[model samples]
Target: MTDLNQTALQKGADRALEKIEIDTLVVGAGQAGVAMSEHLTKLGVPHLVLERNRIAEAWRTGRWDSLVANGPAWHDRFPGLEFEGLDPDAFASKEQVAAYFEAYAKQFNAPIRTGVEVKKVVRNAEGPGFTIETSEGVIQANRVVAATGPFQRPVIPPIAPKDDSITQIHSAQYFNPQQLPEGAVLVVGAGSSGVQIADELQRAGKNVYLSVGAHDRPPRAYRNRDFCWWLGVLGLWDAEAAQPGKEHVTIAVSGARGGHTVDFRGLAHQGVTLVGLTKAFNDGVVTFQADLAENIARGDENYLSLLDAADAYIARNGLDLPEEPEARATYPNPDCVTNPILELDLAKAGITSIIWATGYSVDYSWLKVNAFDERGKPKHQRGVSGEPGVYFLGLPWLSRRGSTFIWGVWHDAKHIADHIATQRKYLAYRDASQRSAKD
Candidate 1:
């Protein structure tokens, strides 16, 4: 729900007011856009990247202060760059990751114009390309890669009562444990963000209630290798999103405390209360579904399935890897799910704040293209859209399971760059003034 609109309002007072034209206009300066810039430059395709704010703005501000990447540094990075002053297995802090992107862009000398807010993009009135209305002025480009990413805005469920007595905020706005009021905290989602935040609060001596939802609980390491490496080796990273049973599979892996398996039971044993999916909220009372047991069972199922597949793959390959028995060991179900409270009054429970760790809702209102579906999702094959010259990148499951990862964006950009290289406009545009309707 946040953008650098205020910064845009300040405007680029230092730059000139002259109009601009290009063959390809890259929208965003995040990992995706920067990667696109690298490949376009390598392929001799001229392009410009327009960013509303500085590079890696989200990693610097949108996430929590204590957050680290879910994947380790070695397996989660681009092909040629290794994180500085960090071990390969270490999880790079948010600050380090942001710094890496800034340095990466500088290394390539990417043609990036920061602080440029693209207000709207539509077909040219008198030509065959796009006319972009920006805060600085106007621009024309034959092709545009919408690389702003999918997590444009946060989405909080409408179940919570519209009351101001208790503080509430989306996880994107959360920075640390001390910023919240002194009392119990209710986090309504069990994804990586919600679970990690809940763990931090409980460790800080605050009561935390986590609403368990559907998520894949993969071990941080399996068969002497991290799950990220296994995914790459097993070709799961390139797995198609259209495959069955992948409809709702958000991984709950975390790289905290030197990286460990994601265990909700362990969280419950450590004093963090686990509850089922949040149902509704009245004046101050909250209702929860009586499905906590089912939720825990589903997580257990996912955990076992991964172990089983890894074992089978190892046996088939005849790989000599040490057996990690703890991953398959069963533990007793915690009391939170077995004898849980179906409803509770927030005031009586001493819960003073609520954090909604729900996922994001994208905003493509500025994209005046006929490439989106009824739900506003882009109707595309991989990154190629039904509407020509409009491509999407850095979106989850855009091409495969790893499409959302940083390295995935890098490799995916190469494909897009190669495709654009086939166009006659790649080397040079005909002219800046005369863009015919058929062009």
Candidate 2:
């Protein structure tokens, strides 16, 4: 029996060496991968998308049951599919998003290989091709588009230095409020996830301490001067810092850096005390760096400044004013007010649970390809990388609205698929030339 098991393992390892032939191989099947496949199929391109798990795994396994998209329903749909439901404003649940992704794959007949975990992706030194090693099999393609997404890994500060008594968990592992420790809880990271988690814990009757970071605050309503409109108008969604122009800006100024878009006002009303940025956690007490209100205000100002810069760029470039496609009425100086902030120590507040809502990290160490920028972010232009035939999708700010939301991925996918088609032709020509030379 032991020999049989060993034989099977060896066979699987050998199969990993057999490089299957393909035109293009995408390493992911989440929103970005599905969108890429849809675009490629629409353009009649031959490609394969590799997913280690079922489609839309994040929506299936990561999110909480009570969670709904922060953005409107219209903003949730991907390419070739419209969000279906009675309420257009109603946010879709995680299950709904997953179902839609599954349907998208079936509807378009996207060539996807599920349960195929990509082990490594490396550029072929001999030619303008690349090799991808996966658990199911190996594949060599003329082009590779990594749609693995930014949230490839859960990130916890290496040294949180928190007391052993304080239970700590990343937001990825958190399911619901019931899982929280008894007594008060301190939710760190004020991004969308952090604020949302804090809101839930407080509503569940648990005393909650929210560590507020610098973050953008947008109105919940759709048909108004919301953040998305400003995103469109300012071209923040499409502007790239790598682009050689004054329109480009670093991510720090963008305020779109981390995914923190929860309704702070609602959370505050629920009695979730917003504290300043957490400096350290030890001896059952959380130390803060500055005033919570000051940090939040600074974050809001950064977001507003980015918007202003974007608006200026539009005027300078002679771009037409953005039309609010679904906006019903403008909320000029709306009644919505800023969520007031408070600074309090966790130990004094008697907080028990500690949830880190501090966003995610992307690790491309497995890729082993020379395609990243100084910050390890993939160097790509609308999904096409500097390395010929290499591409990336679902990257933040790849194009207008392409990075932050699912609805925006199509813009980058369409362009990337078009680029893939050209590469396919190039590969075909090259192969023919090689055969003729041999003959």
Candidate 3:
């Protein structure tokens, strides 16, 4: 976790650049990059890890103050290091998560140089490797692993009007309810962040309007096990993303205030006005789709389906898991659906802020390699890219549903490191064979 802000390595423009050669270079200090470094170290492979900011920068700066890991400590942690003194089912807070990563980096004295940003990476035309141009010195490496992670660019829909009275911010920018202006708040997107933010604002004595959309809702815990435990037992964690026709599922659970199942009906009961997907915002008027009832129904369906599967698994395996029938119960908020507010004048509703909880977009423009498709998605099997020695780690669905999590990225990194080891061996063997031929 060394800060090189005052050093020559941090100032790339003024420093006299020299060619630095290495066998492997990992570009990130987050979970993916650090895991990759660990694997390389185990293989006795020498590589340098470059980071634009300090270790676990995202956890420290990008997230809200009270945010916790969506997954339980036992499920999402890296191997060889257990989350100390915490219950297996308890969620780790953002600061604790950040500290864990920092400790992990220090455990092996990872070759991580913070304050070094990678601007561009391209194939070395003059040689058989890659030329990485960074904020620091340039490095020519036989292999490069782009472990920059999934959440790079935030996306906000361009529908809001110019309302100077209202404070608009993306969910990533939101820290807490006190950060917003004093008035009603509108939270767009019904994903994990959106629901959590809307709930928090409502609990803080603010009138909150939550935009509901297609989402998957599973119980926080079921039958004496967390929902994630069921997923693991069902082999869903190792499975790839479902077909396109299926629902677009983002994690909707919150580890805040002792996590509970996400329910629009329950939120509506708590006075958080649940509306349909936002249609537009213009001229101090906000309109929504007439599908509030449908959204609630959809979430209920997702919830029940998961419970049914869990029950079936228990019965089929002849295991003695409890049959908590109360988990299947749902109380409908008739006013929320029957009297849905499809439109509202911003001034009339007293709404003073809008938090866009829309997710993120992956940016790989700096990676100037033939490893992507027309849709800008990386083209590869697992983490190994089509371009030799160019790999992408810590991406969603890169290998399985778990690839987006800490443990999953570690597995992906190990695979990439093993591949690099094989490639290095091939290089040495080629030289030996050529010398033998000359003799």
Candidate 4:
């Protein structure tokens, strides 16, 4: 039965590929792309969503099986489809999240063409629309929405030394400790991914060394509510202070302890060896910076700043919020602040594996237009690109702090759809006027 259904779907996709023109071409079928497609469908626009793989491919394959959403199920729902059959506060696993997106696409009957990898998106030289060359066929679209998401490619630093003797894997490729060879693991980058992977490895009874870097350390819950709830109340998610082209701080969330705070201090106390930023790797010797203590202090300072902002917001609004519980310093134990290990021999430490949780970079090489800036980042105003018919979605701070998250992309999607509709209407009126003048 499933095979028959797939066959019918493939035939329909083939027919769609034969089409020479479409109203809009959405170049992704993740949460962002499906949301955009749903809005476009409501606007009665003829559109197609192209996915390189299956729907929600990132959640299906990019993440580990045990990985769950950082936010709760309630907060991760798309428009019109709240998470049911699960506890609202429970963290949805990777499989569950993927299934949610799949269900969303099916529910809306989103026009998504799976396995259709877009090769290039270039402006049509002979017309006002764009010519999208995909693996299936060429598609001419009046407007193109790039919802390829924030994490395009895993970034490994150029200075990272490579040796065939050690097994190195990026966080994207890392599944679990069991997949790695027998030895201690050195996890680099102190962001969410780094901390989570380090914690997992440590819990697996493997000796884990976590490299501490600049990061934000917000408590998972604050004042009897989740930190995200307070952030929403304080309007921090929509803060105007977050400037464009700035690297955003990572929020550490750990489901291991029922969504408790995951920070360097906490990890240090959990028998995980905390180290400074990895500086270099030569031969079997790995050198680290002497700035772990400073980084931890910086993180604490940032946390304090967040609390101060929340307090000021409460005062200004005259809202009687619950006072914070007695303050317990995060790093009370002097041993938590370890003496920086400037250098270590990987072989001597029995560290056979290195997991680089260094983060991701956006790849827009397939987009052939002047829409990108010098930094190769799309130059756009709240999802609307400088190019008339070009738009972007799922970009960090595209519309707000929540723009990149599943919960916040609906607004940007709706805005983009509406903008496209308005522009097309104006174009139609202009064309009619020109024809009448000619007559």
Predicted model with the maximum TM-score? 3
Q: Write the per-residue lDDT of candidate 3 for residues 1-439, one digit (tens) a residue.
A: 1112212332342343347666787888889988998898788677778889988898989888888888899987899687878788889998888888888877776777788888998997886888889876677778889898988998888886777888998888999998888999999998889988888889889999998887878899999999889989989888887648553466678777766788778888899988888999878999999998887787788888889999999999999977799997787675868888999998899998999898888888889999999899899898899999899999988888889899999998998899988887898899799999999
For model 3, where is the 10-residue window of minimal lDDT? Answer: 1-10
lDDT (Cα, tens digit) per residue for candidate 2, span 224-250? 344555566655556555334322221
lDDT of 4 by residue, 87-174 (tens): 8888888888888888888876787888889999899888678888888878788888999988989999986776888899899999
Model 4 poorest ten-residue lDDT run: 1-10
Query: What TM-score would you give candidate 1 relative to the actual structure?
Result: 0.92
Pairs with backbone N, CA or C atoms under 3 Å apart (clashes), candidate 4:
none
Clashing pairs in 3: none
Local distance difference test scores for all models: 0.84, 0.67, 0.84, 0.81
In order, what is each prediction's RMSD in angstroms? 5.1, 7.9, 3.9, 4.1
Model 3 shows how many backbone clashes?
Answer: 0
- After superposition on all CA atoms, how large is the RMSD of candidate 2? 7.9
TM-score of each: 0.92, 0.78, 0.94, 0.92
Clashes of 1: 0
Clashes per model (N, Cα, C within 3 A): 0, 4, 0, 0
Give candidate 3's root-mean-square deviation (CA, Å). 3.9
